[model samples]
Target: MNGAPSTVWFDRKRIAPNVPEDLESIDPMCEEIGKVIQLEVDQGIPRNKIIVGGFSMGGCLALHVAYRFQQEIAGVFALSSFLNDNSKVYKDLASSDCRRPPLFQCHGKVDPLVLYEWGESTKDLLIKAGVMCQFHSYPRLYHEMNKDELDKLQAWIDQTLTSS
Candidate 1:
């Protein structure tokens, strides 16, 4: 939840390449993140007290992990990321019984990589699935975070942190 970027290399077990035989890769970075969360939980940190978030690729993984382990996290924050899974993930996301943990997403209107429309599309998918979410899109910004977006994200964490 530091909001800082992490640049760690992934080992084989932590990665699942999206190939014909391995269309769903489990990022090794996620394992590291899970360990961090478990460590905090073991140290008496309330499960709800822990927040998971990241940017771009990290953001996508954050969403994926939160969804994969929904019962373990209180909330999730994903910025400029997309929910990627062949078609199963989308099917799961669109299913009626899917209960989404609280989610926050921010995207740049001019993001060239993931495209702002993808964010909007994800928002629409969540809405269709009855997922409760807070989303924001800034005009004229690219893939990186801006001061305003960070401030808003901070406010969201503050609000969700205290809420049941």
Candidate 2:
């Protein structure tokens, strides 16, 4: 992760979604990111050794890729991010028997762009669907991430990826 990011950034030049989420827009991007994950597998890397996550809209895409791909990874985290109601990730995890890795979701209590309530709702949905989520909230934080959360997230990553 330090030197190999394996990033897949889709151009954000398309029309905005008419609804809460436009699967049409999201699917293609997820497909490309999925390709990256698959490539890792093809290269003999175990799926459980990979970790995928993002911030804001990128976080939303990461969730889609993780659940749609439906394989175990080291972990996932969503920072100041939220998922639309009835997100397919919920549906997929609810129906699948895969062993999902722990999730490390964090949000600011005062975030305006992605509301704190929205973040909470996303956590609720994921938990309700039986996903293991470690949700964190900052009292005076905003839409951006901070050192505290990053430190905690890094620790979580180390623990999750450690060979136990």
Candidate 3:
């Protein structure tokens, strides 16, 4: 499997409408991912075989893109991430008729950077939107993935790939 890493920077004050900003950055990031998906399609790969995932900011991006992409994808894997803008995301999800794939979200309970509550809230949002989400929380972990998280992630991937 090939992995792609992308970086984007934005001023927090400029983006924040409320406590949580409407992340306009997701738009360009999704466009970039869309191009990558198109490239895979051009190379004869089916869209359903493509799983979009990431850690932290990347994970947030993955969820935003997958939920709004207008196509059914394999699955989404998010670690230590949360929704950027709840109202916008909910609206997008509610209006879409595309097949919503399963989501696996892993978070560290003691994470200082991205609070554990944020992760749980994100999972709750997805679940309320009628999306299937598997959420795992680690007791003393903080802002990083552990071995147990990796194992669970692997199982989720295996199950998702096999069932799909």
Candidate 4:
């Protein structure tokens, strides 16, 4: 500890051992999300009302599941994250029955772990595939969320939930 604030961390090595090559290792997480979604549906929640999102690795998984999920959901929120498997996402987007939920992806310009270019690439890719994605970049920000991001996220959640 270098006297910095403690933060939540995901074990990327264990989650995606091959990094840029083998993103399939995270597929199990998407399966778990499916189970949770099933449970939510069984409990009387409509699938379209469910919004999936997270930060960092969790955000990556959220994108993966939302893109590949058979049912259309409310939206996807990914913060300080990038697509785990660009090829897989492209393939999924090519499907005729693919879900095209609105996506809100926010990243920091100064993010050291996940470069800004990666996040931009993700937004561009999704847009090219005809997905509605709102991308926000914070100047001088790091690999974390700030008040502005939170405020925007809150507004997005409110609007999406009410409109849908």
Ranking by TM-score: 3, 4, 2, 1
Number of the top-ranking candidate, with TM-score as the measure? 3
Candidate 3 global lDDT: 0.79
**Displacement of the residue 5 alpha carbon in candidate 2, Å:** 26
Off by over 4 Å in 1: 1-24, 27-29, 85-88, 93-99
Model 1 TM-score is: 0.77
Residue 65 lDDT, candidate 2, scale 0-100: 79
TM-score: which is higher, 3 or 4?
Answer: 3
Give model 4's TM-score versus the native structure.
Answer: 0.84
Instruction: Please estimate how well model 2 matches the true structure, expressed as its whole-model Cα lDDT.
Output: 0.79
lDDT of 2 by residue, 1-164 (tens): 33454453433322122135667778898888778888999999888888889998888788877777735777788898877776778778888887666789999999877888888898888888777899999999998999999999998899888952
Q: What is the TM-score of each predicted model, taking all chains together? A: 0.77, 0.84, 0.86, 0.84
lDDT string for model 4 (42-144, tens) is 9998888888999987787787788886347899999988774435766778775666888999999999888878788878888988889888999998999
Clashes of 2: 0
Shift of residue 137 alpha carbon in model 4, Å: 0.8
lDDT of each: 0.69, 0.79, 0.79, 0.78
**Residue 79 error, candidate 4, Å:** 0.3
Model 3 compared with the native: what TM-score? 0.86
